[model samples]
Target chain A: MTGSAVSATALIWVDGERASALPLPDRGLDFGDGLFETLLLRAGVPQFQHLHLDRLAAGLQRLAFPDCLDRVRNCLQQAAGELQDYPWSALRLTVTRGSAPRGYAAPADARPRVVITAAPLHQDRCQPGAPVALDWAQLHWSSQPLLAGIKHLNRLEQVLVANQLADLPADELVVLDAQGHVCSVSAGNLFMLERGQLLTPALETCGIAGTRRRLVLEQLAPAISIPVAETHISPAQLTAADEVFVCNSIRGLQPVTSLGPRQWHDHSVCRALHEEYVGAMSC
Target chain B: MTGSAVSATALIWVDGERASALPLPDRGLDFGDGLFETLLLRAGVPQFQHLHLDRLAAGLQRLAFPDCLDRVRNCLQQAAGELQDYPWSALRLTVTRGSAPRGYAAPADARPRVVITAAPLHQDRCQPGAPVALDWAQLHWSSQPLLAGIKHLNRLEQVLVANQLADLPADELVVLDAQGHVCSVSAGNLFMLERGQLLTPALETCGIAGTRRRLVLEQLAPAISIPVAETHISPAQLTAADEVFVCNSIRGLQPVTSLGPRQWHDHSVCRALHEEYVGAMSC
Candidate 1:
C-alpha cells in the first residue's frame, strides 16, 4: 500500500515473544534455512491465512523439520491479534531450523523457530496500479525439483533479478529457468492468456506456487468462465501469448501492458479475474 | 568439533560491533539475500584467510553490494584477535545486504552487514576420521550458474539433503544436479581420483568452489605432482574412480571408502596430499 494516510504499529516476535532482534547464530540468517509468509492483515485479520499456512507447512515438511504446524498457527494468530489497532497491515512470518553448530550437518535435536513481524499498510496499497511494464531478466532460476513450489528462504536469484530491474525501464521482469523455460516474474507467479485459457508455467522443476496464483486458477477463473492449466512454457511462447498478468499476495494481480518489443492493451480477462478475486477477499 | 575440550570464546559481530543479536529486517534472514564464509582458526590465526576473503569479495561483487572488502577484512581481523585464547576453532563470516524494507526489490540506499561468529574446536576434531560411507542423496542440487561456485545463504537444499543422511548409515552423501551430473557432498567439495589425475565436477552450473578444494587442486596437487582437473562427472564416473574424497576448510580431506554397492580402500594419494596440506597449514 502506498501514498495513503496510515497509522502504523510495528511488532517483532521471536518464538511467540515480543522481541526486537534475532540471535546471530540463527540459521535463517546464516544458511537461509527457513521459510516465510507475507500476507495482508485486513482489519486485524490475516487474509488467506489457511492458504499461506498450508504452503508453510508443506515447506516445513519438505525441509524435514519437526512438526510445528500447530505452533505456527498459534504464532500467526497471536501476531494478528497484536495488530488490531491498525485497520490494515502487512504481516510476515519466518520459521527457521533455529541455531545450529558451524556446519551443514544438522544437530540431532533441532528445534524449529517461528518469528513474526507485522507492519501497518496504507488502506489504498492493494489498489491495482497502472499496467506494469515488463522485460526479460538477465539471470535464470536454477532447476531443482526438490525446492520447486515452496517459498523457502533461499532467494538470492530474486535479489539478483531485482538489481537488474533498477537499470531497466520496466516494472517487472520475466524470469526463465536454467533450461530457458519461462518460469515466472522475478517476485511473483505469471499466467498467460492464450486461446481463452489461462496457462501458468508448471513449477515441477523450479519457481514458487504463490497463494494468489492458486486462488485465481482454482477459484476466481472457474467462477468467471475461464479455463486454467499448468504446462511448460518457453520465452517464445510467453511472448506469443494474447495477454499476461503476474499475481502475488501483497499486490494481488497486476496486468502487464508491454514486454520490450511486444505490447498489449487488452487486459479484459485479467481485469475480470482480479475484480472477482478482490470481491471474494473483501467478503 | 564435538565431545572434546572446546574453550570457545564465542564472538558475534553485527556490522562491526560485538553484538549478540541482529535486526529482524536483515535481508539475510528474510530472503537469504547474502553470502557467507567459514574458515578454520588454528593457533589464533585464520587459515587460508586470503583465499576466503578473495572468494567473499568476488561473491559481494556478484551480489552487487557496495565494495566493503576493506571493512570485511578489518572485521575478520578484529574477530580473530578476540578469539586468540582458543587454541583451535571454527570462524564463520556472514555478509548480508543489511536491513531493507519488505519485498524483493532492494532499497536504493541499502547498507551491507558483516557478521562474524567464532567457536572453539576440539584439538582432535581435525584428525582425519575413518573412511567415510556415502550413499546417493535423495535431493539434487539446482543448476543455477548465477549461484554456482559461490557460498551464498540460500542453502535449503543442503538442509534437505542433510536430513536424508540421518536415516541412512552414512557419514556423507553425494549430490547430483537436476541433469544427473555428479556435484558435491552435502557439506563439502568432491574430488575423484582416476588414472593419475584428480577430477572434480565443474561448477560452471552449480556447487561451491571451496577454499580447501582450491588449495588441494592448485597447491597440494601441483606441489606433489598429482595433476588436477574439473570436468563433468557422472555417477558412473564417480563410482569408477580409483579413489574418492571430500574436502572442506574445517576437515582437510575425508576418504570415501564406500558408495552403496561400490567400495574403495586405496587412500595413499589422499593421505599424502592431506598430510602435506596439514603440515603447511600448521606452519
Candidate 2:
C-alpha cells in the first residue's frame, strides 16, 4: 500500500501513562539521547524478547536512565502479538531519559520514557546454503569504547554508508576500523577463517555485539578465534584471513564472495552458521 | 508540583499541525535519524535565532535529511512562549524525516515531523564564571563524515559519556576522537592558541560546529585563524599554548585555566568573548 492507508503509532510510555505525547524538551530527539533495539517476532510472541529487553536495559544503564524497564517491557508486550500467516515481525524498542530540562547533564530526578513500535517482517535472504557477495568500504571506523559494541542510538555512519551502497549493486560493504582492521559490515558483524579457525573481530572496542551475533557464538557450539584488540586492527591481519562471513539477526550468516581486492567463495563455517540461524529463527 | 499540576494537553504536531501523536515512525528518533536546535529565549523571540537556524539547516544538509526549516521555526515558536519568569527557558526545535518505513532507507514518500517543546532552563552549576574544571575523559570519538560536524540524533556517545561524567566533580570532560585529536568538550567547542595565532581543529572531518563557535570567530575579527582539522594535539600542545577557551551559545566563552598542566590565570580572548556573548545575549 504505497499511499493506501498504513497506519502506525509509537506504542509509547511517558512518565506513567501510555501517552503519545512526551513532555520533556526535544533533547532526546535533538541528541540521540537514547538507545533502541529492532527485534524479531514469530507468531504473536517476540522471537528474542528477553534479549532485546536485556539490551535495552544494559544500554539505559549505560545511558544512566533510571531503570524503567518493566514499563518498557509492558509497552513492548502491548505492541507485539501473533502475526497472521507465515510468521515473523520486527519490533523496535527505544528508551530515552525522557526530555530533560535542558543541556546534557542527565536529569537526576526525571523519570524515563519508553517508545516501542512494531512492523511486519518480510522474509530475509538468510538461509542455509545461499551465498552473498560483499564489498569493502573506504570509510574507516573510529575507535571508541564509550560508544562501541553497544546498540546505542548513534549510527549515522551505518545509515550513510548503507545509503551510498544501496545506490551501488553490492549487497554489503566490509568496513574497517580507524586503525585499518576489518570491523564488520554496515548492519552485520564480520567473521572470517584464517587456517580453518573461526575468527571475528572482538568488538571489545568497536562494532555492536548483535543479539544474533551473540547467539551465533553461544547458541551454536562453534569454536571461534577473535582478536584480543586493545585498540585498532591492522590490515595485514585481514588480508591474511582465509574465509569471511557477515551476520545480524535479520540476515544471519551471509558468506562473503569478495572484500575490496580479495575474493573467497567457499566457506563451510558460514554455511553452518546460516543453517543454524534459519533453523533457530523458524523454531 | 509533579503531582499538583494544573494540567492542559501537551501541544503536539505532525507536519506542523495540532496533533496528539505521530502515526509515522520518525527516522529521527528511530535511527537518531534527525537534527535539532535548542534555542534560548528571554522574551517571546528566540535569541540567536538566525544563528540557531543556520546551524540547524547546516546539520540537516550534512545528514541529508529532508529539511523543512521554516516549518520547524514555526513549531519552535509554538513550543516556546510566555511562562512565569524563571532563571532561564529553552525552545527545543527538532525535525526528522517525518516517518520512515521499517528499514534504514530514507522513506521515499515521507513527511518531516517537527516537534518543539518548551521547558524551563535548568542551571545545574552555579558561579558560571568559576572556570569549570574538566577531565580528559576515557571516552574516544569514532571517525565518520556523515555525522562528523552536524548535531544529528546519534547522541548515544554523549548520552553514554554524560553518564560517566555525572559522578565526577568536574563540570565536563574534553573528548578525544579516535585519532588522538581534541574534538570538543561535551556540548561545547574548544579553541587553543600555540603562539598567539588562534587554532581550532577542523570540524569538517568531525565534531559538531556549534553556532556559537561561528559567532566567536565572527566577533573576533582580524582574520584570527579558525581551521577545521583533526590533529594529534598532545597534552604538550595545551601546556605550550599561550591561551585556551571553550564556548557555546549558552555558556558563552569560559577561559581554560588548567587542562593537563596548561594554566592561564586571565586570558584576554576569553574575557572579550564573554563580554560580547553576555552583551549580545542581553540584547
Candidate 3:
C-alpha cells in the first residue's frame, strides 16, 4: 500500500468526451493554471462528492476561473456512472482555465476544461489501520495566502518532497512551512493527538484544505467527542504528542507508527476517528 | 504592443514529432513538474539560444528531471529550422517529466517530453522603446529558495497578477514578495536606476532569472559604465528611482513611464542598455 499503482485499465474523459490526449495549449499544461481533486469511489458512488465539488468551486473562484462548475459536476457524475463495474476506484478530476492563444491574461471568453480519469483501486490498499512511517523532509512549503487551502495544480513543492521521500526510509515525509512550522505530509493532511485534544495545522498561509480533513474536523471527531483545534504545531510538539495520524480522501485514515526516532504502538484516538469516518462514508 | 497576440499560424511539436496534442497523463499537466523557455526567433535563429538552454538545463537539474538536455536542443533546433519562413517568431519550449502512473513519486524510467510552439510575432510589438505604465499589485510572491531562479511551470501567481492587471489601468504591475520586498513584474525581470546606480532584485529568494536580464547585467551595463547590483529592493526605493524598466527573452527591454503617481521622463540609462542589447542580439 506504500506505493499504490493505477491499473492499466483506466478510463479517461476530457470535457465529458472520452479522449486520451489534452489540447497542447491548455493553460493547465502551460501554467498549471488549474485545480484537481482525488476522490474515492465506493460501490460506483463517489464518497463525499458534494464536498469535493464545493472545494473545487472555491478554488476556481480563487483562481478567477470562469464559471464552469456545472460542467465539471456533470463530467464527474458521468465518469462515475461509467465506473460502476469497479467496486473500489480512484477518480481524479482536473479543471483548467482551458486553452488560450498565449500569455498570462486569460481570454475574456475563455472556456474551462474538465479532465476525469478513473482507475480501479486494489482492495489491499484500502486498509485504514495500516501504520506508516514518516521522515522529516528538507523541502519546505512556501506561504501563499491566496493559493493556500485550495487544491491547485502548482504542486512542484509536493513533487520535490515526494522525490525526497523516495530516497529516505519513510513511507511519507513530514513537510514544514517556510517559517519552520510543521504543515502537513507529502500528500495528505496531518493531525496529532496531544493531551486528549486533536490539533491540525491552520491552512491560512499554506497547505490544502482537504475534504477528508474537513470531514474529520466537522463530523468524525465531533461525533467521537474529541475537541479539535486548527492551530500551528511545532516539530517538538509533534514529536512529543501522544498519537499522530494522517488522512486524505482516498486513504480515509492512517496512523503514524513512527516519525524519525519516535514510535507509537497505540492508536486508540486514530482508530475511533477512523471508525467514525468509515461509517460516515458508507452512507 | 501591450497585449501582443500569437498569430493564428502557429506550429507545434511533441517529443521532436509534429503534433498538436499531448498525452493526457503527462506530469507537466498533473503536477507542473517541468521547465519552460520562451525565446525570440529571428531569421530562423533563436536569439540568446545558449542562455535560454543553459537556464532550462539548470532548471531541469534542479527539478531532478532525466537527462534530456540534448533531446531538448535537437527539438528546439528542428522547430526553429521549420520557422524560417517567418522573420520574427516567438518560440515556447516546455519540457515535462513525461507520462507516468498516478502518484507524486517520479518513476526511475521516466521519459521527458518536449513541446515547442512557434508563432510569427507582429513587427509592431517588438518596439523596445515603448514606455509602459504600471501599478502595485495586491498579490505577492511566495519565497521558495529551491525554485527561485528556475523557470518552472508553476505560474499561477503570474496568472492571478495578470488577471489583476486586466482590471486595472496599468499595462503591468509591480509584484512583491511575502516580505514586502520588490520582486518583479507579472512576466519579466525588473530593474531600477537610482542615484546613477543600477539595482535589481536578487533571484536567490524569488523571481525567474531572465536571459535578457543577464545580458543587461553582465555585458550591457558594464560596457556603458553603469554600476549594477542585485539586492533586495523596497517599494519606496522603486518609486524614488531615477528610471525603471523590465526585460524578458521575448521582449528585449521596456521602460516604465509612470508607476502610480510617480513618473519617469528620462530614459537615458534604459535607452543605452536597450541599444546595447539590440546590438548584441543582432550579432
Candidate 4:
C-alpha cells in the first residue's frame, strides 16, 4: 500500500519536546546526513521496537554518529506511550547529526537530534496476506556496502522508484541492484518459495535488512520447519518461483499474485509465514 | 578549505520570508527529496549565479520536482541584494518538495520550499590557487547514473568521506567510483593535467558537475590553449599526471601539491586556469 497521508491527528516530537518544526540547518535537511526507522505501533505499543532500535544503533555506528541510542529509545518509548489510542499506527524515528556548520565534516562535539512522528494507519491497510501485483522498476539500486542495510536517509533512490510507481499499473515495484540482481520491493523485503525452501536476497551491497524480514528469517521460518537461505536471486529465478511475497514492519507480509504475465495462484507459503509472524509479533 | 562556521552574522530565509525553521514533514528532511546549489558570494554578487541555477534546474527536472526555478531565482536575487556588506560569503540555496505525507512518492501538487542561507567567509579562505595535499579515501562512491552529477541532498557518501578526512594528514581525499575509477576530491571536481592536456573523470557514473569545474572545462582551459577531455581516470593515471587540481564554486581552484609520496612543484597550468577562471567569475 502507498504511504497513508499523515493526518492532523498525528503526534510529533523533536528531541523529546512537542514541536512540528526543525532547524533549517539540521544536517538531516542539509545533507540527508541521518538515520531513520519506521515501526508499527499496535495499541500504543511499538511492534519490533528493539529490532528497529538495534538497526538504528547499527546505522549510527556505521555512520560514526555520536552515542545517541539511549536518547532515541527514550523518545520512541515516550511517543509510543502517547500513541496508544490508535489501534494501528506508524511510528517514524529520525535521528540527525543535529545542526552543524555548513559542511560535510560533522562537528567533534556534535549533539544529535531525534524526531519522532506517529501517524495512524487505516485498519484495513494493516491486514497481512493481501496479494499485490508487482512491476520491475527501471531504476536500479547502486551498491554501497558501507551504507547497505542501515536505513540511513539517503533514500532518493526509493523516492525515484515511487515516482516510477505512480505511473505503473502494479501495486508495487521490484528493484534490482546496479548489477541487475534482485534487491527488494519499493518499500519492503522480498521472499520467494522454491522447492519447499524459502529464499531471500542477501542485502550485502544494497537494500535495508528490514526488521520483519529478520523476524521471518531468524524465527518464523525455523519454527514452521521451512528451510530458508539468503542468496543472490536473479530476475529469472524470481519469476520462476512457486510463490513470492513482500514484507515490512507496517505491512507484515503481502503475497505477490502477479508479475507482468506470470501469476501465482497458490500462496500457501506466504500465508503460513504471515500468520506465524503476526502471532510472534503479538508476543 | 573546510566549510566555514555559519556565524551569527549569517542571514537566513525560508520560502521568501526570514526564518530558521522548516516544517517537520518536509520531504527534504524525510527523503532528501530535493536539490541544492552552493554559490560563492563575492562583494554581494553570487559568482556563476546562472550556472548554479542552471544546474539546480536540471537536477530538479531529473528528480521530477515541481517547477520552482523562477521562485528560486527570485529568492537568490533578493538574498544577494541584502548581503552587500559581506565582501566574501557562501550562499546555499536549497529547494525541497515542501511538506508532504510520510512516503517516497511526491504529491501530484508538490509545493516546493526554498531555503537560502548566506554565511560570511574569511577573506583568507576565499583566495584561490592554494596547494593542498591529497590522500586516498578508503571509501569509494557508488555509481548511480540516475543521480550522478546532481547536487541533491542525499550526501551521506560525502559525509563518510569527510569522516575519513578527519583523521588523515592530507588536506583533502581523492575518492574513486565503485569500479576503482578516479571520481573526485572529497567536495569538489578533480582534474589532472598530463602532456599539456587536461583530463577530468566523466560524471556519467558518479560525482558532481560543479559550476567552477564547468568554467575551467568550457571557458578557462580553452582560453589558455589547453585541450580537456572528460573520461575515465585510474588512480595510477592520476598519480602519474604532470599536475592535479580540484575546483568548486566556493573554492575556485586548488592545486594538488602531493598525493602520498608524489609531489608536484610546478603548478603553472593550475595557476593559469585558476587566474582565468577567477577573472571570468569576477566579470
Candidate 5:
C-alpha cells in the first residue's frame, strides 16, 4: 500500500474523461472537501461494490456534493471493466467538490469531480494465518462526532498515525479517540472476540465505518451464526479479548497477533470470518 | 471566498514553476494530508508573510510533511510578484505530501508538492467600520486536539458550516465544538471584549489558529495595551461580552454587529485593533 509498484497501465479518470492531472485549484487538494472509497477487485469486478458505492453516496450526501451518484457508479463499473486484465486489483474512487476559487466556502454551482485509480492487488495480505503486529498509535484521533463514521478525505490523523509506526516494529497501529477509548486501527475497523460475541468499537465519535466491517455486522456474522455488537471498547477490554481482528475492503480480515506486549495466537474466529467474506466475494 | 470573481489573470505555481494542474495521485487530494495558508496581498506583496509561513511550517512538522518551508516561502514571493497588477489580492499557499500510490500509508520517499495561487482581493470586505450580522452554526467543530490549531487542508467541516449559512441573512456563522463550547466563526478566529480583557476561545481541541488572530495576541494587543487571553468560552460568555469581532489574514478584523437577537454597535475595540493591524501590515 505504500509503494509505486503499479507497472501496468493504471486506469485513471477525471470527470468521465481519462486524465492523469487535476487543476491546481481543485477543492479536494485545497481543503480535502471530498469522499473516497477503496474496493478490492476480484477477477476484474469490484467485490462488495454495492456497499462501497452506498457508502460513497452517503458520504456525498453528507458533504452536500451534487447528486451524481449514478454517474459515479457508472464510472466505477466502467473503470473496473477496463482494468479487468488483472485477476486481482485495488480500485480507488474519489468524489471531490470540484475545483473552486480560493476559499473554504464551496460554490453553489460547483460540479463534483470523480477520480478513479486502479492498481494490482496482492492476495497474500488477506490470508488469515498471516496476522499483523500492532502497537498503540502515538497520536490520538480527534473526536468529531460530526465526522466519526464517514470516509471523508480529511485523513491527516491516519497519515500521522501511520507515520509514527514507520520506525516501530508493527504492521498496524491501534488508535484512540481524544477520550482514549479504542477507536480503530490505523487503516481499518477493529473487532474483538470476547465471551463468544463479536464486538467492534462504536464509531459514533471517531474512525471510518469500513465497508468490510459493515458486511460482517449486517450479513456475514448472521450468515455464520456469530453474535455481533457495536459498543465502546476500552484498551483493557481489547487486550483481554480471546482474539482480535481488523477489517477493510482492500484487506478483508487480518488477525492481530500482537499489540505492544499483548499477543493473541488463537485466530480461529478471524479465520472463519475471512473464509466467509472470501466465499461471499466470489459470488 | 465562494465566487469566481477574479477578472485579472491569477498566477499559479506548482513545485516552483508556473503551472495550473497537479498529478492526480497527489496525497493532498487523496487524503487531505497537507497544510495551507491564505494570505492577503496588499500592494503586490503578501501581508503577514512571516506569520503565515511560520504557521505553515509548524503544520508541516505536526503532519510530518517533508521539510520544504524555505522553498514554499520563495514560491509564495515569486508567485505573488507575478500577479502584482492588483493593488489588493489573495494568495493561497499549499504544501501536500506529493503524490503516492493508493493508500493511507505515506511513501517513505514521497516528495512534497507546493502550489501557490494568487488572485485579486476585494477591498470592501475589509472596510474598517463595516459590522456584520452573525448566527450560531448548526454544525459543530470536531474535537481533535492533535489538529485543533494548525491550518490543515482537512476543511470539510468549514465547508459544511458555511453551506448552512448560505440562505441565512447573517454575514458569518459562529461555530461551537462538539462539547458545546464556543470554537470559532465559520471562516475566522473569534475575539470577545469582556471586562476590558480581549478573550478568544482556546483552540486546544478545535478550530484553526488563524494568522491574524496570532498577530493580535502576539503584537497588536500588546502594542495597543488591550489585554488578551485564550480560554474556554461559552455561548453565554460570548453574548455577555461588551463587543465581539472576528479576524483572519484576508479580512483583517471585523466587528460582529448582531448574533441572532443580541446586537452590538460598538466599533471602538474592533476599530482600534483593526487600525493597529493595518498599520502593522503596512510596515
Candidate 6:
C-alpha cells in the first residue's frame, strides 16, 4: 500500500500525473470540499498505510465518495514507486467533488477528483514525537456537530490556530470549544495523564480522531485501554493532569512540553508508548 | 468597481485562455481553502460590486493573502470582460492561495488565484420578496470561531443543514446554532422585525457578513435600523417578531412566509422595498 520510492523526499501525483492543473471548478480547491491524510514513509514503505487509507475512507464516506478507495490506493502506489529511493517522506491523499453547478447541491452522479501529492521530508515539522511547546489559544472552537470529528475539507480553524501561534512561544496550540473543553491541538489529537491513565477527547462532539491516537490506545504497549481523555473535557481536569501529548499519523506522538503557563516533566508513559508504537524520534 | 461586463451569466475563460487552470495546487480546493461571493447582476451591473470586492479583500486579508488591491482588481477586470452581455445571472468570484505546496505551511510568497465563473440564470430558486417557506432543521451550525462567519470554503455545516430539510421545505431553512439560536436560512441573512426596527445576528461572531445586509442597512430605506443579532439566538425572537425576511446578494429579499409549526403574513415593508429598490426581475 506504500509508495515505491525510498528517498528522503516524497514523490507527488495529482490524478496520476507528476504535476497537472486542476480546473477552476474543482470542489476540493473551491470549497475545501475534500478530505486528506498525511502519512509517513520510511525506506519506501509507508507506516500505517491501511489505517490512513481507512481514515480517508471514513472521511470519503461521510462526504459521500466511497468509490475513491481504488484511485487512492493506486495513486499512493504510483507515487511511492516514483520515490522508491528516498530515505524518508510523507504522502498526502485528497479527494473532492469535481466541478459542480456553483452550489453545494452535488448531484448523486457527480464525479469526484483525486489529488495525491508528496514533497521532500523535513528534519523538523515531521520528525516524529518532538516535544512541542504549546499553549491555550484565545480562539474558541465552535461546536459543530455535523463536522465535529471527521477530517473533512473545511480547515479554517486549523489555519487560524496556526496563525495565532505563529508568533507565540507555542510551536502548537490546544483549542477549547465554546463550553471550555479541550478539543485538540492545532493539528493533532490531545492526550493527557491524570493519575497515569491515558486520556483523550471522544471526538464525537468535536476534534479529529487521529488514526495514531487509536493505535496508541489499541496497539501500543501496556495493553489497549480506554482513553483517560474523556469526552467531557473540562479545564479543571486538564489543569490537574499529570502529563499531556498530541498524536497524528504522520507526526506520531508529540509530548507537550508546556500548556498555557503550566509545564510538566516529560511523561515516561508517553515516551515509552511513542517509542514502541509510533517510532518516536529524538529531538 | 464592478467588472465591465455586467450582463453575463458568469465569467468564462477556457484553459490557459486567461489563467484558465487554477494552477494544480490551489489551496481553496486543497483546504476548501477559500471564500467566494455570488452577486446579483441587474441591468448589466453588479448591485454592490465595490462592497462585494471589499468583502473579498477583507476575506483574503483574513486568510493572509498578501496581494495588492490592484492585483485583485486586474483579475476582476479579466473575468468581467468575458461576462459581457449575459443578463440577470449570478456572478461568482473566488479568491484562493493560488498554487502552493502540499501542506498547510502556506508559502511565504503564495500567489493567490482568482476565478470568476457565471452560470445560467435560474429564477426558480429565487423569486422576489414573496414569503418563502422554511423548516427548522435539526442540525445546529458548527461553532468554530476560526471558521465562523468568514464565508470561507468550509460549508459542510451548510451542507448538513441543506440535507436535513430535504423532506420538508427548501424555499428557505431556519438553522439553529449548537446553542439553539436561529442562525439564518440556507443561503441568506435573516432579519426579524421587532417593532419595525430590523434585527439581525452580529455576523462578526459567525455567519457571512452579507453584502445585501450591508446595503439594506447602509443604502436602502434610512428609516430602518439594526439591533444586535448576536450569538445568543433564541427561537422566541422569531415568534415575537412582526416580520421576518432573508437577504443575500443573489436572492435579493425573500420574506419568510412560513416556519415549522408557524406561519406569518407577508409584510408591507418587504414588498415596498422590493418594488422600489429591487425592481422587476428580468430572468
Predicted structure 4, TM vs. truth: 0.96
Worst 10 residues of 4 chain A by lDDT: A1-10
> In candidate 5, how many Å is residue A70 off?
1.0
Ordered list by DockQ, greatest first: 3, 4, 1, 5, 6, 2
Compute the lDDT of residue B167 as modeled in candidate 1.
Answer: 88
Clashes of each: 1, 14, 0, 1, 1, 43
Determine the TM-score of chain B of model 3.
0.95
Give RMSD to native, each candidate.
Answer: 3.2, 5.4, 3.6, 3.5, 3.5, 4.7
Query: TM per model?
Result: 0.94, 0.81, 0.96, 0.96, 0.94, 0.86
TM-score of chain A of 6: 0.88
Tens digit per residue, CA lDDT, model 4, A191-221: 9999999999999999999998898899889
Model 6 TM-score is: 0.86
The fnat score for candidate 4 comes to: 0.86
Q: For candidate 3, lDDT tens digit of each residue in A70-129?
A: 889889889887776677888999998898887999999889999987788877334565
What lDDT does the true structure give each of the candidates?
A: 0.85, 0.65, 0.88, 0.87, 0.84, 0.68
Model 6's i-RMS, to one decimal, reads 2.1
Ten residues in sequence with the least summed lDDT for candidate 2 chain A: A223-232
**lDDT, residue A111, candidate 4:** 92
lDDT of the structure predicted as candidate 6: 0.68
Task: Output the lDDT of residue A83, model 1.
Answer: 74
Find the 10 residues in a row with the least total lDDT in model 6 chain B. B7-16
Per-residue lDDT of B1-283 in model 4, one digit per residue for the tens?
2244234444888888888788778899998999999988876788878889889989999999879999998998888877766678888899999987778899999999999887887764345656799999998999999999999999999999998899989989999999999999989999999898999999998899999888888899999999999999999999999999988777778999999999999888988887787677652
Q: What's the CA error at residue A162 for candidate 6, in Å?
A: 0.7
Return the top candidate by DockQ.
3
- The digit string of per-residue lDDT tens for model 6 on A47-147 reads 77877788878877776664868877888887776654656667777777776766655556767777776765655444346788877777777766556
Q: What is the DockQ score, from 0 to 1, of model 4?
A: 0.82
